[model samples]
Target chain A: EAGVVQSPRYKIIEKKQPVAFWCNPISGHNTLYWYLQNLGQGPELLIRYENEEAVDDSQLPKDRFSAERLKGVDSTLKIQPAELGDSAVYLCASSRTVYNEQFFGPGTRLTVL
Target chain B: SQQGEEDPQALSIQEGENATMNCSYKTSINNLQWYRQNSGRGLVHLILIRSNEREKHSGRLRVTLDTSKKSSSLLITASRAADTASYFCATDSGATNKLIFGTGTLLAVQP
Candidate 1:
């Protein structure tokens, strides 16, 4: 079985620009999550989706960050007017159930100049 | 937000030595899980100890959870160079089943 997959392993854009990252969860995985990892820090949850509905998103910065999971399979996270602080690794993970361990993707490393 | 903090932020050991990492977390949790991450890569699940379970083992790794102390420890016996990586502890406490991770312990095993 395939693990969670993320696209554009690396991205670089100027501040105030828009950037997007895509994720494809493993087949049969019902829960999907997006996380941000800064240097020397652990990954922080950004948004989580149970099937097609977002069940947790309080940590997301709605001012510029937006996320969507269409059809409960793949997900997309976008940052409009990216800020320098947004420069970090965006990781995607999925699990068969909420109680199970999550499988992570290679992550999309973004650099906002 | 981070829920746990791993002690000995960095450690170095010989290839055949045992390595131990400690994690302390705040609040009540349903489970505590360990994960390993190599440089520039995704995380790999190592082990999980439920709140009800005090100890668990897998291969050369052992994890002990002390709910009363809100602390956990991961011990890798006879670790090899391949074991060189960062280890993190994540806590599951919310109804959403989300995990709150710790900063992690960076271990280097010299061959």
Candidate 2:
């Protein structure tokens, strides 16, 4: 079976522009997560999805960032009017159950100039 | 929010030596997991230790969790240059399935 997959491993856009990243979790995994990783720092949870419902999005920047897990199998994270601070690696991961070990994707490296 | 803190912001060791990193977390956790990240790319899950379990091993990796102290340790035996990377410890805290991660420890193995 394939591991989690992410698109556009590298992305560059100007500040105030819109950027989107895509992720496809592993098959049969019910829990999906999005995280932002800054230089020399660990990944921080942006949002979490349990199937089609987003159970937690407290860490997400609701004003400029929005995410969807349409069918729960795949998810997309969009940042409108992106800011310079948004330049970081966006990682997607999935697990078979809540609190279980997670598998991660290569991640989308976004550079906002 | 960040939940755990890893000590020894950086570690340098010769190949074939052992590397050990420690992590301390706040609040109770159902499980603790260790992950490795190369550069700024994605993270690879190394091992997971449940709250009830004290230790776990996989290949060259060994993880020990002590709920009494709310701390965990990861030991990599017979390390190789390929082991150079950033290691992190994460915890499952709330009911949202969200994982809180620590600052991380950078390990550089000299061949």
TM-score to native of every candidate shown = 0.98, 0.95
DockQ of each: 0.83, 0.73
Best by DockQ: 1
Best by TM-score: 1
Which stretches in model 2 have alpha-carbon errors above 4 Å? B39-41
Model 1: CA > 4 A from native: none
Give lDDT tens digits, candidate 1, residues A1-113.
87889999999999999999999999999999999999888999999999999999999999999999989999999999899999999999999988778999999999999
Chain A TM-score values, per prediction? 0.98, 0.98
Give, for candidate 2 chain B, the lowest lDDT window spanning 10 residues.
B91-100
Candidate 1 versus truth, CA RMSD in Å, comes to: 1.0
Per-candidate local distance difference test: 0.94, 0.92
What residue pairs clash in candidate 2, if any at all?
none
For candidate 2, write residues A1-113 as lDDT tens digits. 99999998999999999999999999999999999999878899899899999988889999999999998799999999999999999999999987567899999999999
Report clash pairs, candidate 1.
none
**lDDT: which candidate is best?**
1
